[model samples]
Target: MTTITTRTIEYPADALTMIGHLALPADTGRRPAVLIGPEGMGLSDVERRRAEALAELGYVTLAFDLHGGRYLSDPEEMLARCLPLLADPDRMRGIGNAALDVLRAEPRADLDRIAAIGYGTGGAIALELGRDGADLRAIGTVNAVTTGRPGDAARIRCPVWAGVGSEDPIMPPAQREAFTAEMQAAGVDWRLTVYGGALHAFHHPPVDHTVPSGVGYHPQHAQRAWRDIVDLLTECLPVTK
Candidate 1:
């Protein structure tokens, strides 16, 4: 069984306070740690499950909440809150940095093998961390949006894997292609995989409800993405034992 604990870490006055959950293997030791950023809808039950799953794979995982403590299922409300934050890229980087600091301080975490993963807004946050040279071992993002800055790609020092849906309205095929081109031009080691006939939030399995908009859930894609994340972490942050 995995041992999980939830806690809140207060940031400086100008930064947001984060509510996060940490999970570790029941047999505990110094293990690789992953900082997980939540999706646009915030840290819902589905995201928590993902962290627990990573714990099962022998990682000490911390799923950080970007929204503080608020969440909304309505599309308009979700966009209203998430878009402004996304627009201010620096704020996202600050949040990621704060989470990274907290995770690095954990005695049971292998600081040298830290990695990050995120979805939607969270994905963008994870990407910004890597772009800012955060010393991450690896990064994986699902259906993330880029800020379209040119020089940001050159700062990444770790392997990056991005998963996107071909039909994702938020990140269209052209945008994804352009992002990939920029990454390649920067000489960053990166890989991108696009799933056909899928939409945004394809990795959120428990989010199936009639929101203010017409969005639904895709359980199959979500499961597959979760498995991919596990594999990526294992490959990038392998156990030393």
Candidate 2:
């Protein structure tokens, strides 16, 4: 097994003290880093584990918090908080920028080699960061491709990769088409992968709570989606060995 280390880091955003999980490889040199965003439920063990796995790949990684480090397990509560936040790009940017600041402050992070990848609401935040003209090497989102304000996507300077379950009602065919049209009109290099036989949050492991309709887990596609995301990092943000 690869040698890696982890720590809990905290920062401020939106009147809340955000908690972040940082993971690092054992190497002494600076390395590329990935900012991971979790679903609307907020940062959970799944995202933290993703940070560790990314660290194993030799990239410093940070799984950032939403909702001031609160993980909302109730569907109504999660939606109540996330829906408004998702609708506000400025708020999303604030949250993402806060996490970016925390990540950039880490000695192990390579400021020029940063990627943002997120799931669900987290993915929307990542997209907002890119749309706000952040210097991102790549943006990978799973199940969070939503329509943005007019001409906003033009600000994205990096490639965008999105994955979604084919049956995702929250991001159905019309939504996907609109997102693609925006990307195309913006002339951004973008890719969309639709996983068949899956639903929203297909990448997630089985959860113990009820999270509204149109959400499920598909282990096979989840692994495939992760591979696709890793490919995005490898192609756009490779670290020096």
Candidate 3:
């Protein structure tokens, strides 16, 4: 059985000191690394567990933070913070690059082989990193199929995979069409998975707080989406055990 190690890391991003979770596998040898971006609500135990799970699978993983050690349950607060940040690609890149730098600095991380997977706001950050020409092996995003700046998708130097709920009003068909169109125009190796009968944030677990309409969890789809993400990494950044 693989023994995983986890820790809390602090890094500067978006002018705030973000608290991130780092997970490392038992082996001391360098391994392919993955960066996980949390949803707009911020980093929570969910993301931390995901990082640990990836580490157990033999990859160094870092679950980067969005709200500087805070988790916002208030939808209004989350939107207020995420709206502007999402609008500016440079800010998103700054956040992603900062986390990437931290992941790269880890001795166990193979610098040349790295991937970015994110959800919600974090997904947007992953896409922004790709658009900024980050050397990622693959980019996997869920529930945030945002179209990047015109002509920027061409800079993505990796396979891009996106998963979204088919009925997600936030990421409706038109938005998905735009995103796919951009990817197609850029000639990127890209794919999209639409989970039927699911709503926005289907990958996320149910929260104690009341969520906005169209946002809910689907147990089966969540598991499927996770498997898809693992498949993406396995295909693009395989780790030899």
Considering every candidate listed, which one attains the maximal lDDT?
Answer: 3
Query: Following a full C-alpha superposition, what root-mean-square deviation does model 2 have from the true structure?
Result: 0.9
Model 2, residue pairs in steric clash: none
lDDT for each candidate structure: 0.79, 0.94, 0.96
How would you encode candidate 2's per-residue C-alpha lDDT over 1-241 as one tens digit per residue? 5489999998999889999999998887899989999999999999999999999999999999998889999999999999999989999999999999989998989999999999999999999999999999999999988878999999999999999999999999999999999999999999999999789999999988887899999999999999999999999998679
Regions of candidate 2 where Cα sits further than 4 Å from its true position: none
Which digits, one per residue and each the tens of the lDDT, describe model 3 over residues 1-241? Answer: 7588989999999999999999999989999999999989999899999999999899999999998899999999999999999999999999999999999999999999999999999999999999999999999999999998899999999999999999999999999999999999999999999999999999999889978889999999999999999999999999897
**Best first by TM-score, ranked:** 3, 2, 1
User: 1-241 in candidate 1: lDDT tens per residue?
Assistant: 5465544455431255667777776565899999888877787777777777777777888888876666667777888988898887688888888888888887889988999999988899999998888999999999884744678889888888888887787889788988888788888888888877678877766445445332345777777777788788888999765
What ranges in model 3 sit over 4 Å off? none
Clashes in predicted model 2: 0
Q: Each candidate: how many clashes?
A: 0, 0, 0
* lDDT score for candidate 2 against the true structure: 0.94
**What TM-scores do the predictions have?**
0.91, 0.98, 0.99
Error of 2 at 74 (Å): 0.2
Q: Identify the runs in model 1 with alpha carbons over 4 angstroms from their true place.
A: 1-14, 145-148, 206-214
The per-residue C-alpha lDDT of model 3 at residue 144 equals 93
Residue 2 displacement in candidate 2 (angstroms): 6.8
